[model samples]
Target chain A: MTTMAERTRTTSGAPGGTRTLTLGKAVNEGLRAAMRRDDKVMLMGEDIGPLGGVFRVTDGLQAEFGEQRVVDTPLAESGIVGTAVGLAMRGYRPVCEIQFDGFVFPAFNQITTQLAKMHNRTRGAVELPVVIRIPYGGGIGAVEHHSESPEALFAHTAGLRVVSPSTPQDAYTMIQEAIACPDPVLFFEPKGRYWAKGEVDLDAEIGSSTLDAARVVRAGTDVTLVAYGPSVETALKTADALAQEGRSAEVIDLRAVSPMDTATVVTSVRRTGRCVVVHEAPVFFGAGAEIAARVTEECFYALEAPVLRVGGFHTPYPVAKHEHDYLPSVDRVLDAVDRAFAH
Target chain B: MTTTNGSNEAIPTLQLLDPEGRRVTTRGTKGYRDRAATLTAEDLRGMYRDMVLTRRFDDEATSLQRQGELALYAPSRGQEAAQVGSAYALRPRDFVFPSYREHGVLQVRGIDTVDRLRFFRGSDHGGWNPYEHNAQVYTVVIGAHALHAVGYAMGVQRDGTPLDAHDGTAVITYFGDGATSQGDVNEAMVYATVNQAPVVFFLQNNQWAISEPTTRQTRTPLYRRGEAFGMPSLRVDGNDVLAVYAATQEALERARRGEGPSFIEAFTYRMGAHTTSDDPTRYRTTDQEEVWRRRDPIDRLAALLRAEKELDDDYVAEVQQSADELGVRLRAGVRALDGGAPVSTFDDVYATPHGVVASERAWYEAYEAGDPPADQYAIAETAQGGAR
Candidate 1:
């Protein structure tokens, strides 16, 4: 694995210069840029101020901005979100950081019942332009609650736009877009990919149109592999292995889960006729299940076989030693792809 | 004034007017009484009128629910002084976050009568624009908006709204004694005190949460919970309009001065059932009801006005006429309310265009138009766009 410092080389032409940054640093820069752009944009979370958050995703923000802008809040998830709702009502955009995925349950009511429904409940007269950033997914060898993918629970609720970034560049741009968005957004950061380095264009403007749509990361015709967040990297690796096996595979990165770009998946599946949905969430009633149902509905006659899924089983995220088998890996994704072709 | 709890310990409570409607100013009530003294007879009469109108509105809403015009109704009968007085203390620019049962507060805040009934009528979740009246839509989930109030106050502080001036803005959130048990409420106090956010937590300790008594919510006096958070906390007679008004004024002033959040536990009672759906008879006794009936907020305020020579038979008749007119308007407006088109349900669910909502809306529209499932899918596909 390349160290983050080894990836920190900069290109010379652009104003700020295109630089390779870890996903976490990219998000920090994104937040920094957003704060500079709008004084109303503020950061609130536990240890988000002086300590710069546990993951250091918010490092140096409080030093640059004042304590008022980068608030270090009490250790309460519901308080973070609920108060953010108030701030949004008062015309401030508050970006809340939930330290881990599993801990988000404490604020589940605020997110789903209040933050998600405030706008609709008020007939669009009120806009809660708040962003909740949750570091999600496994692979760092952490304990139980620290490593889990709970994206499906939020995506199932209406009045919220749930999105995840698979690459450092996407993380950089999407964070800013999520802040500028007029609706409340749940931004699930793939913690496993925090140190995964990629070149990010520092001067790039946010393209709002692509923020909620799926993108075809790799194109092929033999079969289609759908994945998001951490699993996107796995899907890409699976596609590479398929190519070596003399099989062509298409890879779709589902950036947004709630307002899923299903049409893109449908269009791709029409040509490929084979689909495998992948994620780290439990397969039962997960985001993959929704994608599979939509794909089967749209491309029923065109599909060579039924839509297949590769994901965590319907059980608690197992201990670190067993997480390898529990999480959907390249091998699991490849196996599902091969099964798609078996029919 | 003081009352003994189950433990027989004396608990001080502020009351400007006793149950008999005569002025009573003990050491605990002196400062608050002085604040109430600032109001003229006209101001007192105005407060009385608001309480009367609010009670009349509650009665009408309750009757409407029984007539099947409304799906449910949460009466604000016994807690009129607590709601109206506290709301009266707020400046026009100061924001308010109220629970579902704050009909009197909504009335005092100038929320439209029809809009106030929309939630209970099931025509809309909340029909008023929060920014319009500097008041948020009614929050049904217990204690959730407490955090919002604190957060809004923090925003106000960041916005550089004056803290030491009378013009400085503040935020106040209303909840019941039952809300004290919620984690969000306690978390709100933690945030408010730590951030020193200019907010006031007005607790209408109406003595019950649906069927459960206040004892189930907390062992100590509810105001002590605020004291525990290290803020100025007080208990006031909820039936006395002057006392409630004085307490809220002091709390709001403390907040506007950037002194941080304050808590006021208005010791009131729920003269009516919690809501039209609730059966208070099952858990509470008629004897307890009889004890509180004599302490009705509206009647207490009337007696005060009568003693002060600010009210007469004609004035009472005039207020009653205004309430009767309001009842007529609410009935007409609610029945005439349109829930809007069925397809409009998909509207406003998001601020930006969402593919899922658009797709479902397209399918629904096609289904309504008698299109086949194939045609519906085609329309949905078109609605979501062919590709990114």
Candidate 2:
């Protein structure tokens, strides 16, 4: 098994004019740069101040920006997002953090109904440029609500842009870009890979890396493996393992979950002729489900086999001891790949 | 804290005028009475005219809905004073977040009656631009906009608008007793108080939320709920236009001065059913209706005007003529409103162009146009080459 540090080293292979940073640190630097660039950019969430957030993703931000800009709100998710709505109306870009994925439901009404529709309801007279950051997915075997992959819930909603970053570079750039976006953005940070290191170019044009564009991380001819967030790393590993065999596998990192960049996936699938979708979320009605359905529809003639999916079962995210069994492991992804080739 | 008199019984619903159209001045509301006295006869007359026009508009909308011109109508029949008075107290720069039944408030905030009709008429979600009149679109989901108002008020504070200078910038959020039960409203109050936001939570306790009474929503007086959240709150005679205006003006002043959020529970009643779809007789009795009918806000003001010799048969007839004209205009405008949905329903789903949305929109358009499956499946041209 490759350690996160070894995998990170392999992934972040960029040479000149780049810095090696863990995904968390890269995001911190990105937030600092965004706040420096725009005075209207502010942070609001629980434990984000002093404690530096439950995951410390916002470490040292309060000290740098002062208490006003990096506000530590009470334990109220709804209020945090709800107030962000008002602040946005008042011409401020508020970046709200939901400590965990499952906890976001408390503020779902505000996010879906208020923050999402304010633009169209006002006939574009008002723009809610708010960013809601949720740390999601499972790997370290956290308890129930903490490990849930609820991106599909957000993706189902209109008026919101849902994106997840796999590599540190994407995390560094995506957070800043999401903040700069004119519409509301639901940024899903892969907490399982928060410490994964990657090379990030600080001087690169910010928001130039199109978030909604799916990128082919690994190229091959035999099959296309589609994944996002935590599963992207797993899919990449599966692709590497498949390279040792006679089969050649390609990997696509779906950075944008909602408003999915399926065109890239379809193009890859057309050449590969076979594909497997992977994610830590429930396979039923998940982002992977949508990707599979989309691939079949768009690349129907191009596919040699039906698109297969590797994900968690429909049951609740299990306890720590059973997490690995529940989550989509590299073996399971490869099995799905082999099944695709069986046809 | 609760706005209680020395005896601490919660100052018996502050009122400047009785139901019988007589001035009943009390020590608790003396300050407001003084403020009301500053208004000339013309100003008072203007307020009366607005109330009458709003009622007329509400009646016309209700009729339109019944005639199938509108999809639905949320009536503000009895709570006109509560909405109009607070609305009139607002400065042009101040923003208002209203629950669905604030047709009168929309009128006071410069949104045309025709523009307000767009929502019910299904022509548009909200026809007027919020920036044009400093009023947000009507929020149908109860208590949701309360937090939005808090957030906006917090933004108002950060914009360095000089809160203490009375630069006419603040936020007012409207909701009913039922909405206070929602976590969003409570959370909004939490943020508003913590941020010291320049927001006034104008809760028109219209006694019933649809069919559920205020008692079902809260045990203590609605005003006391704010006290628990560390907000200074007062109960006002929502039927008394002068009292409602005075109370709202004071709250706005407090907010502008950076005194944090204030709660005003207007002790009003929903004279009509919750909406045109509801039948109040099934849930409420006629005796209750008769009791409230005697305290009609418009009639009380008219009585006061007649007693002061400021109103005559000629002036009454003129106001009725104006109301008739407004009704005619509303009827014509609503009937002429387009009932067809737009071809681009997917537009504005996101401010920026999204590939999936673009694809879906194309599919929908083709389907609506009765195109073949091959044509329907084709993806639309992706929106510009920009950051997604």
Candidate 3:
């Protein structure tokens, strides 16, 4: 029997079901779903209004909601989130797209100081319920200050929920849930994965990803392959390839980066006894490091072979083909799997 | 059309006083002495008090940073007047967004001074709720918070959120000269203008971006930079708390009246390093510092206070005592914060972790149940059960 989740992505534009949809499109669909259900939903970004966006993620949004709702903003990232603080004060749900990952740094103040911890900081007087969408990761091979996986930065902030989705389904569901929640959320969509295709059931409302939960993408008895965002697809491919080798690798998708769902991961690790974690960011202090450390601590006894990490080299995401090598690959996952088996 | 300081070079920018502390009024004989026409003396005196207290706090926080009580501190010594004046000018309902260094502005907004310290101390991200005092948290990043302010202002414009013109809410964001270089800063202006979001872009032009000078930041005047983005720009004397207060009030009122966005460049100087990690002497000279030193805002206000005898010696002593007490409180707060303290913070990953995080949590649980390595980071080297 074929379950609904077993279908391959045939119709695709972007994450929200298009072959050509950029990460920007997936985010647009997320915003649309959230806004359609709740009038309080609004998006603000630089060039996000009449101009669509520098990347055009917010194209035609203002027209749908009017200029007052979809704000174009004065090239002020800090102000965008800063005023989102105010809008949320008046009971409006603000979804701010930071345009680019590198650009998001400027608004880090608002995100870290204000948006990240508004609920707890205010003693629950203000429920930010704001979604800050940032196009992250390095695959476009753009210039300096373009491709970066600063998820660790956000994940390191308290009082803010951090989640990343690898598929259109997750994107659609999670974006809506983010708007519905009373806490602030940092929604990081891989700029490179925006064009990836996936099926979306418009009729079904995907509820919240457990505030902190991990999902097993593939069932396996040997090694648990863990990753999220763009890395999840890679891990999936790696798991499929591993299946051909008769090593049923369990794949875990880390939809939430912070307030990490260690419980689910530990259960998977305890079940598999072996694990290989992966991510696109550098290994030094990336999300992969935190996952590897915590998993080692939580799933310590369950492991037969040691836990290993497959991630980008400890260097700045280089240009062109170098970036391809820089990012973890199926071969890297297999190699980590080999190391785990040898142990 | 050719407005200048009656000079062939156009005076470069407007000025009510040079660094020499000499009164150099702009066009028309309204003069610096009569600058108070737009501001009340009592307001000016209150502004002075705010500046003094903010400076005291700023200095105390800086000490905490140097003493390892804080990870970093962006001291706004000279820019106090700019922040306090601009912030205090806003209506209670008006929203304020500030860069990391806006402690003075936070004080003006009734922010718990300890809250700012907690953030820098790394005790917790931010300790205050923006809505509690009608102010947003201090964004440590460059200028992105300005765009959020713009978006919120857009929300305000959409909700028909405000009925009365003067009573309507307005958005104000504070950032340093360095932040103007950020893409979000430029984009914020474009959006705010086209949408006509009732927002004010408060740029504190303190003439330095870390070691980078203001000259390297822009070829044109900072205020005029807003004009290119279709915003009306004003360059005001940042050191004069009265001027900052008056200019900010005017801009906020204009914003509330559907006047769109305005950029007010608070022409001030940064008396301290960008943060504790910075060394200003490497980029600027003592002589240059001396130039701004003569333009001491606090001294000028003190001069004005003395000239009018608005404050007696006893009152000044009481203010000093209050400042000292605040310093002790901050020191105590800083002393209480310890490093390597367990902390977990996620920026804003919007999604509530459902599967992936849950799996990791489960893995961590069982792993912890089994004894881990002697050293946490040495996971690979020290096997869980074997090492334990």
**Which candidate has the top score in TM-score?**
1
Error of 2 at B271 (Å): 0.8
Give the range where candidate 3 chain A is weakest over 10 consecutive residues by summed lDDT.
A1-10
**Candidate 2 TM-score, C-alpha based:** 0.95
In model 2, the Cα lDDT at residue B72 comes to: 94
Candidate 2 lDDT over residue span B159-270, tens digit each:
7777662674779999999999999999888888888888999999888888988768876788878888898898998999889988898899889888888999998889
Sorted into a CAPRI-style docking class, model 2 comes out as medium
For residues A1-343, what per-residue lDDT tens digits would candidate 3 score against the true structure? 1111221112222234323334456567767766665677788777888888776767777887876668766566776777687677667888888878888876777778767655654445556777888888877868876778888887877667788888876776677666676668888888788777776654344444343457888888888888988899899999889889998888899788876665567778889889888988777787877777777877777789877888877776677667777888899889999999988
- The numbered model that scores best in DockQ is 1
Interface RMSD of each: 1.8, 1.9, 8.1
Tell me the tens digit of each residue's lDDT in model 2 across A17-48: 68999998888877887787677889999999
List, for all models, the DockQ compared with the true complex: 0.65, 0.60, 0.23
lDDT of 1 by residue, A218-254 (tens): 9999899999999999999999999999999999999
Best by lDDT: 1
List of chain A TM-scores, every candidate: 0.95, 0.94, 0.90
Model 2 chain B poorest ten-residue lDDT run: B1-10
Using DockQ, rank the candidates from best to worst: 1, 2, 3
lDDT: worst 10-residue window of model 1 chain B:
B1-10
For residue B329, model 3's alpha carbon misses the true position, in angstroms, by 6.9
